[model samples]
Target: MPHHPDLATTVRIRLIEPDETDAVAAVTEAAYSHDYELPESYRRSLLDVATRAAHDQVWVAEDPATGRILGTVWTPLPGERISPLARDGELDFRLLAVAPDARGRGIGAALTRHVIALGRERGARRVVMNSGSEMVGAHRLYLALGFVRLTDREGPVEVAPGRFLDLFAFGYDLD
Candidate 1:
């Protein structure tokens, strides 16, 4: 596949540093809170970048000019096997969020492409993820990037007691 166009030239996508944990959490929580009714456990999971970075590669898209975080995505690396969503031969990512103010600026798409690239580099046969069903804009972006819905894997994931979010699974076959 040809390289995706550089959608946001001013934003640099890289592994976030330790000092930027709070910033990353703020951006992720702010973004997710806008649409998802996050329960306390899920909220804590989103804010715990350090735990994520311990096993997976936690990346962030930052505006180089201001060093402000625009978005974040997590990719499970080989051997860590920490993902609850990825099946064998699939690389999984979670908590892909772009700051509310950064929507429509291509930040989310850029972050998605970055994860796909990482998967390819690591010899992963496919990239998969589960997204909330209500995220129509994110669904559109994933479809535009050539992801296909895996309805067989669709189900409800409980984020808190008695509260569940219907998840739509998507996959990009690298082979």
Candidate 2:
């Protein structure tokens, strides 16, 4: 439960450029590990920003004035396996990250809204996403954006040999 100041007014959502790949990966890994330690598999996935950008849409929330990437999100386009969380007919946004120091600036929400808009533009019937149960702030944001708790999709996944993470799923119907 970190407190972020309200500063979404200055963030701009855009696709990440090739030169910014390392920054995007670093931000994503840092954001997720803020609450818990990441396992090897999870770490590998987070570091694979380039592969994700090649197959799907990798977006970042940037500070227009400073050209800093404050946040990042990955959207799975149709027929692309950008994320295991996404299924057919839906756009799944995964690995949403707002830098620890940048949380209060509304960067996470901006990246999320950008993904939802991408879903609509791709003619998706709905939007889907998965978040760690410990991410209370992100959960609140998703609920406020009209995403509902999909209890049926909730489950525990082994992130490491003896450690498991319970994932919470949320969905927003496009209708």
Candidate 3:
């Protein structure tokens, strides 16, 4: 596949640093919770950057001029297992969130492309992720990037007690 055009040149996507934990977490939480009702448990999970950084490769999108964190996404380390949605030869990412204020500037697209590029570098045959069904904006971005909805994987997932979320699976074939 040809390289994706750089969509957000002003935003730099890079791995998260220890000192930037709070910033990343805040951006993620603010983005995720914006205009949506989130269960407290799930909301807290969005703020758990340190845990994700320890287990997966946590990445951040930064505004180069201001040194401000604008978004984040988490993917497994190269050749490691993380999301159950990924099988052998597949790479998966989760928790793609862009700051509410940064919505129309292509920050989310850049971060997603960064994940796909990471997958390509790791010799992955496909890249996949599960997004909340209500996340219509995110779905649009995924589709624009050549991801197709995996209908077979669409179902309700238990997030916390008494709360279930409808999730849509999207995949991009690297072949």
Best candidate, TM-score-wise?
Answer: 3
How well is each residue in 51-122 modelled by candidate 2, as lDDT tens digits?
A: 989887788988888998989988765656454666777888888898999876667776777878887888
Report the number of the highest-lDDT candidate: 3
Clashing residue pair totals per candidate (backbone < 3 A)? 0, 1, 0
TM for every model, in the order presented, reads 0.90, 0.86, 0.92
Global CA lDDT computed for model 3: 0.87
lDDT of 1 at 158: 78
| Residue pairs with backbone atoms closer than 3 Å in model 3 (clashes) | none
Q: Considering only N, C-alpha and C atoms within 3 Å, which residue pairs clash in candidate 2?
A: 4-104
Evaluation by TM-score, superior candidate among 1 and 3: 3
* Tens digit of per-residue lDDT, candidate 1, span 25-86: 99989999988788788889888988888767889999998999999998776744554677
Candidate 2, residue 118: how far the Cα is off, in Å:
0.8
TM-score-based ranking? 3, 1, 2
Which sequence of candidate numbers ranks them by lDDT, best first?
3, 1, 2
Q: Evaluate model 1: give its TM-score.
A: 0.90
